[model samples]
Target: MNEQQENKPLISLQNVTKTYGEKTVVDDLSLDISEGEFVTILGESGCGKSTLLKIINGLITPESGSVSVNGQKIATPAPAESKLVKLRRDIGYAVQGSVLFPHLDVAQNIGFVLTLDKKSKPEIAEAVERARKIAGVEKELLTRLPGQLSGGQAQRVGIARSIAARPKLLLMDEPFGAVDEITRRSLQDELSRIVKQEALTCLFVTHDTAEALKLGSKVLILKTGKIEQYDTPEKITQQPATPYVNTLVNR
Candidate 1:
């Protein structure tokens, strides 16, 4: 581990396992993510990529093992409500598709969390402005409702909402998958710039190998609920750990 990595982990999972009925979704998973690292989880469909993200963010509980984020121990089966609420407030999650509230306009959607917390109007406005800049949301779009916008635009708004709270960590699961190739590239560029500028610790999940390679400081490959490789993108590209990973990179 480098000096930065040695600075204590921001997210740690030890022997974590999640099962739905008879199928194990995550099998004895253990990982450590350093502060400010952009880690991408890359795997095939149903490989538990999304499930891992959910566990980190307290959306789902593992059947066994432990998860700790920002020094707070997360309880599996059922996380403590107060602690989970506070943790959720400090983490931003952006999933695929437009998750904007159908009734609210872009600005309202972006500032929804702050509004729920009853923040001052000025504070909410300031946060919305910063989020808009980061997400490339235009001023004109702020007044437009979700149904009025294109897929890319709606996704931009969704991202804006997720980051408006200025959370310590961001978890994204295929957030750009629904857009066209050109729009997806544009969103990726925008997101890359924004996350770097903000110095955010992020865990991004994607099935697209190129996207994973392009965005990750470190890439984690999973197969059958087990880790295949966890290394820098360059290393993963140059020296894949398994036949599946080699073929994945080659293609």
Candidate 2:
């Protein structure tokens, strides 16, 4: 990519809003995320962090405004399913819990997307190996099912599967929430390394204030469906924009 292309935002949201009955989950939210940025969305429960992620990956359609990923318009008043599928293929998504397929063993689970794309056996094997190494998944576990894996191992496999396709964007929603502190920290370090090495843009959602600050290059804090603060982690700590943010920082 040229300088101009690299300078352009890889993800853009404009006047985005999503409502369910009387509740407005995301209200007129507008944000631009540059390529290769690791943005962490930090918020209280029901504060629209996950909702915003869903909108970006085209899992949830906003009631108003627009969303563009990789310069392709994904959300309008109505989005085409075909376009959404194509867009999602380039975006890796992993959420809380071990969301692996029980029927598929580790290798099969990690190679699922590549298999869907009709990749050859050799190509899928190579991608799966790369992903496993990046995510710290053990090669010995390839034949084991999800039910046989520990929480940390399962989470690692989930991450490996997400990156197996060499996605341009990775969306993780509280991916380390269930793991032990040691495991979570290890996973965080591994993820940071992978993001830097792959030059991948990542949007990671977390309710943990410390985790958010530790992981994100840019921290975006939300309150009741609106932005509370968006800035560098250093700036957020040094100069919190709101009392809520200040409390979070202190806490």
Candidate 3:
């Protein structure tokens, strides 16, 4: 990548807005996320953290404005399904509860996207092995079904699946939320290592302040669909931009 391209934001949102009935979920939000940044979106429920992720991923169409991922505009008015599919394939997504296909074995689950894309068996196998190693999934567990795995194992499998496609951006919505505290910490440490090793640009949503602070190179504090503060973790802790930010960082 050229220096200019490397310096440019990998993801950009311009005046994006989303509404459900009479309620506005994301209200005229604008932001730019640079390449290789791990941005943690921290907010209370109903603050549009998940909505923002969906919008970027082209899963949720906004009421107005534009979004660009890797310089390609998305979520346009009535986008083609094929285009959305292509876009989503380039962006990895993992959510809470480790939603895996119960019928698929661990290897199949991680290779699911590759299967859909009709990748060769050898290619799929290679991708699955690389992803599992990165996500900390054991080789022996590859033959086990999702039902046979523990919660932590299932979650790791979910992560492996998301990254198997080698996406440029990763969107994670509280991926560790359902696990026990000890498991959560282990997952966090593993994820931190994985992100660095992969040099991924990630947008991770979490309600936990400490998790946000620890995982994010930049922390985005949201309030009712608006940005309260978008700054480095150190700056946020030292110089909170608003009273709400202060309360969040303090409490």
Candidate 4:
């Protein structure tokens, strides 16, 4: 384990549960994530992977239990906009696909968060450059609009934007799911490098077992809104906690 693992958890969920129209999406989930740790969440469809991420980000409030991030308790049942915005200032959320604004150019899109945070032009420029460099984005693409770029390029820009503000926690939902195999591999490598370099704690949600095994310091497997197993990739592969986990590893 890295030194960061020895530190206190930056995110904590205690008996968290989320229900939508009588359907429980996340049921009594408790998790702790250490600072700088990369945790990948894996599950089949309707297993509540995305709901878990949203709960942590305070985007979706749980019906029961509590959540805290960086030692601050997030209001459950309903989070105030001001509090959510303040909490999210330290979090970067990258949805499944490339979600860049079509009207904004690459540089504009990457610097959008900083702009929202009321950063000066010079600071935004410096941050944008550093983020783009870390994300492996070429300088030539900075001025291009999102519609002009390929899926892979748009995804990279989205990642760059997520990191541009130097958020402590990053939430990525299938960031590489829309691209070709080659492009996905490249993005995966880039994400690993950036995460390590920045020492950013990440919660990545994906359906790809291989991806979950490759990039996560700890892999969390969910089955029907419940935790099937949560452990290191090596441990999960060698000694799965349940039959579902065993089948997932072998499959």
Report the number of the highest-lDDT candidate.
3
Output the worst ten-in-a-row residue range by lDDT, candidate 1. Answer: 89-98
TM-score of each: 0.94, 0.95, 0.95, 0.94
lDDT of 2 by residue, 70-175 (tens): 7788877556787667667755443333588999999999999899889999999999999999889989999999999998899889988988888888888898
Residue lDDT tens for model 1, 89-133: 655443333578999998999999889779999999999999999
Residue pairs of candidate 1 with colliding backbone atoms: none
Write out the backbone clash pairs for model 3: none
In every candidate, how many clashes are there?
0, 0, 0, 0
In model 3, the runs with Cα more than 4 Å from the true position are: 1-3, 90-97
Q: What lDDT score is found at residue 11 in candidate 1?
A: 91
Per-residue lDDT over 56-136 for candidate 4, one digit per residue giving the tens place of the 0 to 100 score: 878888889999988888846576888688667755443433588899999999999889889999999999999999887
Q: Mark the 10 consecutive residues where model 2 has the least summed lDDT.
A: 89-98
Candidates ranked by TM-score:
3, 2, 4, 1
> Regarding lDDT, does 1 or 2 come out ahead?
2
Candidate 3 per-residue lDDT, tens place, 67-185, comes to 98888898668478897786666555433335899999999999998999999999999999999999999999999999999988898998889889887778898888899999999
Off by over 4 Å in 2: 1-3, 90-97
